[model samples]
Target: MASGTGSTEDRSYTERLTRLGGARWKQVLDVQAPYRWNLRRHLGGRTVLDVGCGIGRNLQHLDPSSVGVDHNAESVGLCREAGLRAITTDELESSEEMIPGRFDALLAAHLLEHLPEGAAADVLRPYLRFLAPGARLVFICPQQRGFRSDATHTVYFDDDLLARTMREIGGEVVDQSSFPFPRAAGPWFTYNEFVTVGRLADRR
Candidate 1:
């Protein structure tokens, strides 16, 4: 529901990204290969909701029942081609249309930093309503070095800030770590990855 300046431009960029075949697509897959491997190891058999699933790159790592949502129509088409259920929307405008039942797990890789700080919180707020009693939310973003690649990224979070924000948003910080890979280093020295688990408070 949050409006931004570059909807048209974002759609164009997503369209171009969708056309990336051969080596370009391979490069993307290569960059994501390690993360996908890690996710599979940690998140198999869990019903996952992948927000901003670009080109379905993470589909192979998740279970078949997983659902992916993005703002790009082209990306949604590609996800369908890869045999994953996908939905396209303009932005986090309508949670009712995109988010349905409670999910066992949620994945938001490289997505949080793209929105403005307040918008990021808005995007995450609705997901809380749909989570099962003890669902886990896995959030991955560029720690410091990874922030410059896209102009759309509005805010960057380190491990401490990420953990603090997750706790404030009613999720318990269950696990946290740094993602190591060969990439351009940034001020933070490492990209922080977090896995937060949600819990339902027992009635008195």
Candidate 2:
């Protein structure tokens, strides 16, 4: 795990908005990519909490009961327009109140990089209280240098590091993989990306 406290407030208003817009496009394309196969594998019939669900694009891939949460008011409006259950909160800490009830799974895509190096785990710690035994948490983020190009990215986590960190938070790794974009892929392959799945440990 990388060290240093991350703060979205560190960026200027324009910079933050730019990052948000870029992410929206990236997510739209990503949702259609083959890499999303893992998401489908785990999402069926499960109630999901989509953190940072901009425009609720991913919601289209899930069932009607899934819920999305975003901190951006505009994105929240878009989510509603798209017919997703959504709420806008000021920060991750506010999610408990903004959307009540436990979730069977949590899906966070490229959202963890925005948090400070160790902060992602911190934010997820409390969500554990809302998960049932054997519930899963799935997350996707850039690998290595891929995390730096984004100005809003406060940290990076490789497969091993991310898996280890998740274990520390009472989740056990079930899967960890990547997906490279078309441009990044080698002559034979055409994309680069990664997805990880972990199951919450049984407390009793």
lDDT of 2 by residue, 82-136 (tens): 6778876565455443343467788877677777566777776765665667788
lDDT of 1 by residue, 76-112 (tens): 7778887777777664445443454456777878677
Residues forming the 10-long window of minimal summed lDDT in candidate 2: 182-191
Best by lDDT: 2
Task: Tell me the whole-model lDDT of each prediction, alpha carbons only.
Answer: 0.64, 0.67
Clashes of each: 2, 9
C-alpha lDDT of candidate 1 relative to the true structure: 0.64
